[model samples]
Target: MCDLMPAAQPAEKIGKMKKLRRTLSESFSRIGDCQGSDSLIKPLDTIPEDRKVQRTQSGFDPFEKPAGQVKRVHSENNACINAKSSSSGKESPKLRRHSSPSSPTSPKFGKADSYEKLEKLGEGSYATVYKGKSKVNGKLVALKVIRLQEEEGTPFTAIREASLLKGLKHTNIVLLHDIIHTKETLTLVFEYVHTDLCQYMDKHPGGLHPDNVRLFLFQLLRGLSYTHQRYILHRDLKPQNLLISDTGELKLADFGLARAKSVPSHTYSNEVVTLWYRPPDVLLGSTDYSTCLDMWGVGCIFVEMIQGVAAFPGMKDIQDQLERIFLVLGTPSEETWPGVHSLPHFKPDRFTVYSPKKLRQAWNKLGYVDHAEELASRFLQCFPKNRLSAQAALHHEYFSHLPPRLWELPDMSSIFTVPSIKLQPESGDSIQVCSKSKATSNSKH
Candidate 1:
């Protein structure tokens, strides 16, 4: 929203602080509320399908097409998650993984005793992650322990997480370290990140300074841009999925809900992202989706970063979620969104005629201008096709206008101030980096 520049004088700093506080107060007050319904039950994400695979006689897996600079397939049947650098084999840890004996993807049997579980990081419906240390090289890793259900072999989501991860490599994405399999359970080892963006925000409370927000948003778009180029949809892009290390680098994580896009058809699942970050097209039941799915999420995350609250925190109901969104952005019509009426779930009675509102009005209400207004306009587009692409967003005027010093430092040196740093935008001085060595370290990030 506001640029948090470190002014030279205390009086200037106080004035800036006053301006920021006033802006926040007025923005929250200025919003026009649309009425919402009370409902507490909705599936925020997709349930795993048995994911029937149409395996070719050539043993060519549909999920293994890796594009870009480099691609690696850990195994045909056993896809793995590894840090991108680790994918190059130079950084990949030497380890064995547990696997289903009967599966053709199974490798020669390996022992799971090579790693020691330290503590639990978090748990989800399909898997639980632990802080683990590898005995082979004493490297710390986040071990994702997936529970094997009786009826289903391994959930398709886990397969997607492992396989898709092994093939792709990028700095802003979480690194897959090792996949250790035992007869009873399967463990996915990832390059450990100390905390996620959600926790980072919690530590900062109120909200991060605008400069940091810009840095983070830039990294996020950069990462998403890479994924979209690879033709994979993250599907989920909430704060919890963005990982941050001690040196202040951002990485995208949690591919369990992610899926690769298909040519000719894009229909996947209506239920994919966390309800708060789910895009309007998905909410309206348009399964023929594309990278716009993630762009919409980037918009929600942008708003959350600016305001320190969810843009649309619909608890459980799809209707409630839409209510929160349309309340602020206004309801969409076929006129605003072409072929919107053709969505499978679109019904004549579902929406009432509501006039559109300018996103700038809200930004003005918050006293933000320029890039925030422009980027917000691009990201919050009602029609999915109209949303800005991640690659384009990175080069948007908002980011282009920034001074060189702002993005280079591992951390913003001071309230947006840099010491003895002067480089031209054309100087070819680029500074986006990830410390693979320290990514998994717990050393005071």
Candidate 2:
């Protein structure tokens, strides 16, 4: 009976070992299923700081990265920030990271501040201009507050203007000091000028003195020369866009429509410049315009300065504009202009054969010299290629000496030094005049 008991104990021990082996095998099988479930069981905070800030394998520039995609950034020893998954597939949700000060999306520097509105300068379809002073620096500035639209958050005109102005630094061009972004609108802060040429003309009832006119034109040509050198087109070059400082410094402004010249394959719009200042080529629908396009406007300005009226004030439509132009410069043909007939707006029947007036006729009729007309003629060439470039125009004989080498005008150097003379708003009349001028640029237009 004792021998039988000992054998039974060994058999009992073997049965116990078999039961323990079964439990252990089941636990190992469950552990094999928990391979990808590491994240589900482990908290994100437990991840090593180095592991959370790993570089992404998604090859893309951080600045140009599209939204929704996980942009793995090296966070500064922060916990793992897992990106939410819309629908996770075979792979787990990707982790994302963000910039820390040294990133490209960081804030850039600028100088913008509160300004007391001294007077309203001008208003356009997109913005309102006011003469203002900086609260921080006490510097005068022209504040242009642009109206924002929902469809296009900020207009490309404002964006392009800022971009171009950032690179362009010349005394002749308007200085864009700062661009302020607000929740509702964009503000362009420009260096303040007392008034533009149009307002200045209004102030001077009769006209600018001949010496002043000569000085102004010389400055205009000089500025235009700088602009052309940079391959930029000031598509709008009317008197209203020319800002004049109190000390007689002229700067080109209102670059809303200006664009860098297009490559040879593309063409720009022709209906940009005001009809009166629009060149013959542009009016005739030439899209491949170059720097000479502005020269035509310069010619018209020369005439307007002399006559105190728009030279070719076209009545209703483009046809009328062409008629006005041809009335003064004569109708074009293959003889006068080789490819005149090939222009998009060219129609032989629409043109009438009109003999051109001598350009010097305006200068001569207004008691000025032949050189004024000579300069005007060079700018008013029927063919754009034949027109004088801004650089060439500056070197023309007209600028070589003072006005009236057709000998009746004053000295040019004297007017160049003329200080900005602003009239102090008096008891009532001066205020009234300023108020009228400030009544939105739309009213003036």
Candidate 3:
């Protein structure tokens, strides 16, 4: 029995030795694949207890590998150490790059302690206008506060107006000083104008002289020209919307209905402007129109200024509006207005004419007799194509005799005072006066 046991022990020992050698060989090959070398020294001279145990269990040696393999493993191990060092070093600077502070995306509209709320000026579809003084600048400014608790229509309109007015910078357009957005309210700060054309005409009573009328019309045209050039359409143009300063400078206000013109055939919904100033094309259901629609309004305003009343004040219905327009300017035919028949709402049967004698009588009532007959005729033309441009009218012989300096009026900064509203340090409230700033900042990405 002892002899048999000794023989079995020798066979078992030999088999165990062969298995250990094969395992060591396989471990060396795997270490080579991982680019680890036996001869490569570790960063620390002493091995950790866990590492020593792993080496003993895996049967790894530190000096038996080929020189080429050792060099390859050393290069790979160095690269890994260098990569770890580079990664740790760069992390903080990369984090710091994005940590730099930036200005808030949008300014707060109204801070509670900013402006001293004054009396209410007026109320529109969107907001209630107020006369307020800015605590910071100590200037009096018009404040428009919008209540968002109501229907969304007015708030949206106010936002659009604020967005557009923020970028517009012209003599004839109203200036937007600051915008305040509170928890449930939006407020707009504007430069205060003395009165609008409606009130101005009412106060004058006798109607502006033809020369003054011409001057006002010229300024109105200039404002319109600027707006049109910027691809903006002042959908509502009337005496009410035309604000006049104390020095009689005219400014186009109320951009709730105003829109930038880009596409060719964008049809706005019906009933944009007041009936009296609405053009023939607008009344004929022509939605896809051009700046020519505004020209028609210009003609209306011109005639209203000259006559001391609306030129074509129509009744409630569209047909009545059409008839009133034709009554004053005479009916338009295919020959008179080349595309008259093609209009969306064109109906030849509804055409009629008031007495020419009565029409002339109305013109005389408006005090247009002293001016050149051709001037009135040109302005009163029914066709949008025939209407005078703001620039052309400025150069008309009517204004030629006036001083050239009349066109270059006093600086706006001198005439009007802008009020600065104070804001809390963390409130992020500020005013953007120029249109360009408003456009770039307010536009959504």
Candidate 4:
């Protein structure tokens, strides 16, 4: 009986063990079937048993790996962990690696506390001028503030001016000291001249003496020669643009129309110089003109200074201007200007009878010359090529017997030496006077 009881117990133990094993195998099979047949089950079952065990040991949810292991898995995963840690912890968001707004590359003007704005000087098509002083340096400078919002072309004009001025060092040209660019404005800091040739001539009233004219013209030619040597052309050369220092020195100002002449394939339009000072070639529709254009302006200025009025002031329209020119210089024929017949607007047969005696009488009437015949003969040349160059005109016998030092004009020391001159508001009275002179000069031309 004892032997039979031991055998039965063994049989019972084997049956229980087999049933337990069968139950686990069926559960695993069911789990595999659910995972293979359903996407949800597959995703949920992706977690490895070891990772689940680690999560459980670390008190983390078993659906995800432990935080440390997940962070170590990939750079993006690590970044996510760090972000979460920073957010939950007492740390602020990480700063990005970017350039600071206050870096030196940013544009800023004179220290706000130092520069004091003075009165407005002049307003042009693109900018306004003011006279300001630096409290820090106690220096007076012409402050040209450009309205970036209103200017149409590329801001590179200012950049080019600054860059060009940086390389140029000349006494006869305006000096640029500093450049300031803000988000909305561009400022050019320059050495200011107290007066321009037009203003000085106005103040003098009777017009410059022949000797004074010689000196001014000499300096003008010298400045132009220097500019031309540097491959720069002052496209706009007029009396108003020529700044005269209190010391009697002449310095060319307003480089907005200046350009480096070395560029290839360049052909400038004829409308650059003011109409009164424009050359005939320009009027005839020539674009590939050279330094000779500037010579024509110098000639006009020469005559104006001598006569106290514009030499060749034209009419309102091109036809009127042409008539005025022919009336003064006499109708240009193929004899005087070989190429005049071939000009784009040539009208040789449309001659207006020129009375040389009447023109001479008019020159005398205007008090333009003591010897009207000699002066008129020299000045009334019709062709631009026949006109005198600035340098050649400087050496003319007109200045031969003048004082040894022709440059010694009154208050000569103050001419261009002013560090800064405050720009005053233009009085309507002064403008009227200037306009009147301009008109009279045009009629005479």
lDDT of 2 by residue, 229-309 (tens): 777777778776787666566777877667653323134677667766888888888887777778888888877766556
Please give the lDDT score for candidate 3.
0.51
Which segments of candidate 2 are over 4 A away from where they belong?
A: 1-113, 262-265, 362-367, 402-444
Q: What are the per-model C-alpha RMSD values against the true structure?
A: 20.6, 28.7, 34.9, 36.6
Q: Could you tell me which 10 consecutive residues in candidate 1 have the lowest summed lDDT?
A: 29-38
Regions of model 4 farther than 4 Å from truth: 1-114, 149-164, 264-266, 349-380, 402-445
Tens-place lDDT digits, model 4, residues 1-445: 0000011244554565455344322221100000011111111011222221110111211222223333111111000001111122121112111223355543123222224565455444445566555433444556566556544422444544554565565666666654443434555666655656665555444446555665676678767766666666666676766776545667776665555543331345455665666666666656555666777677667666655566665535555556666777677777777777776666656657563434445344234444333433454456656655544554566555544443343322322334432223222322113343332321210
Check candidate 2 and list the clashing pairs: 246-420, 404-407
Per-residue accuracy of model 3 over 314-413 as CA lDDT, tens digit each: 5345687678777766788877778888888898877774433344455664444344344545555566667665556556665565556555654332
Against the hidden true structure, what lDDT does model 4 obtain? 0.48
1-445, model 1: which lDDT tens digit per residue? 1111121354654565455444422221101111111122121121111221111111111222222211111111112222221222221133333333465543222234545566544444455555655544455556666665656645556666776676666667776655544333556666666666665554454445666677788878877776777777888787767876554567788787676643223436677776667788887877777788889889988877666555676544667667667766778777888987887766758766566667645433224635676687788887888888887887787777566654453421321235432221221222222234322221101
lDDT of 4 at 82: 12
* RMSD (Cα, Å) of model 4: 36.6
Q: Evaluate all candidate structures by whole-model CA lDDT and list the values in order.
A: 0.55, 0.55, 0.51, 0.48
